[model samples]
Target: MSTFFRSSLRSFATTAKSAHHNNHRDNHKFLPPTSFLGSWEAPKDPKEAEAKLAQLRRDYAKQVKELRKEYIEEMELMRLEKQRKDEARREALRVATEERKRLKAQEAEIRAQQRNIEQQQFRETLLKERAEKLEYWRRKVKMHEEKKAEKNELLRRQSSMWVDEAEIEKQILDTVIATTHF
Candidate 1:
């Protein structure tokens, strides 16, 4: 029973395939299009079919070898490109580090120069103040000496103007006694 059923199904599929092809042939009336289903039928000449299958296998193997070689070459190129990019990145970082060091040194030098200038200015200012103080003390000492000398000169003049009244009266008595004796 199963064999009978399968045979009928196969005949029905063949009839359907023939009908479909007939319909397209009647419409276009050209050669049928190549398809997987159409190519699935066994060839009438077994030797020719085997030769075609062997040729197809050879072509497929050649295409696969070519694709694999291309893939390996592409991978090598990608690796070289990655290495170049890495080197570029390292060079940029090195340059940036050197620039930072240079800027830091320049800033330190500027700060040192500013400190020296400030110290020099402070020393000059201190010297100027000391000189002014010495001048003021010298003027004060000279004024004091001048005042003391003026006071001593006034005392000498007053003593020289003074006279003795007792000496003058004795001189007058002696002169009168001498005239009476004459």
Candidate 2:
């Protein structure tokens, strides 16, 4: 049979047995109502009932003590498990935080390297521009020197023409003076 059916059959059997016992006890005429029903009463001998009640109380106390001990043990186990889980969670968070810090530092280093490269490129560009400017100035100076030399040549030719004209005039004046004297 299934477990549910078996348990129900056992419960029915126990109830039937308890009913039969009650019927037998009820048929007795000499016993008082309270004694037949197994309830508390002012017994003819009170000391025996008191002792039985005390023993039952002790048994109940022992069962309660055992239950309390089991409960405390279960609670302690749960507390330790919770603490272990908390520690693992804290360690995971710590590792994640360290990883984030490391990534940020790496990114900062990359950015710094990029800045340095840019600065170096800028310096090179500035040097190239200065070299171009100096080349332009050198070409301009060369052109000016060539023009100055050309002007000096022109002046030398003009002075030579003036000297020839003066020599011719001096010769004509000597010829006129000699003719008048003859």
Candidate 3:
């Protein structure tokens, strides 16, 4: 395992050195960014190498923690925005439903009022028809009474017997009472 690791590091160092030399020769304006991992080498002193490794580990851990905290804060803000939108949508829906109900109730009231008006008009028409029928009957009765009175006067004159107004009124009253019994 140690041999494999050393071989890999040697190859990486050789590649980096070649790239660096090429950059200088070409007079490049910019060099490629270096990674911390590629810069690390095994020190001759084991203790110094261990200390260096530990420091690098600490830096990497701190960077990871900071990124995680930022991600959590951004997620919390997004969640709050979503919740606010949902609440607004629900409120709008509730208001719309209430408005629909109000309109329906108003329409029902209008229909009821129209029905009442129609019923009243129908009743008035029936009363008018009844009044017309009663008037017709009254005219017919008056004509019959006039004819009976003329007949009675003619009969009395023929008999040479004159009936007084009180007697005529009594006879008319009796005729009215007799007709009412039927």
Q: What is the Å distance of residue 11 in model 3 from its true position? A: 42
Task: Give lDDT tens digits, candidate 3, residues 29-83.
Answer: 7766877647878799989998998998898899999999999999999999999
The Cα error of candidate 2 at residue 182, in Å, is 10
For candidate 3, the 10 contiguous residues with the lowest summed lDDT are 28-37
Model 2 scores what on Cα lDDT?
Answer: 0.90
Per-residue accuracy of model 2 over 15-119 as CA lDDT, tens digit each: 999999999998977944564355556557779878878977897899999999999999999999999999999999999999999999999999999999999
Clashes of each: 0, 0, 0
lDDT (tens digit, per residue) of candidate 1 on 1-182 = 99999999999999999999999888886667766445555678999889878877897799999999999999999999999999999999999999999999999999999999999999999988889888888888888878877777787787666545776577666678778779
Give candidate 1's root-mean-square deviation (CA, Å).
17.1
Best by lDDT: 3
Top of the candidates by TM-score: 2
Candidate 1 has what TM-score? 0.47
Q: Which should have the higher TM-score, number 2 or number 3?
A: 2
TM-score, each model? Answer: 0.47, 0.60, 0.59
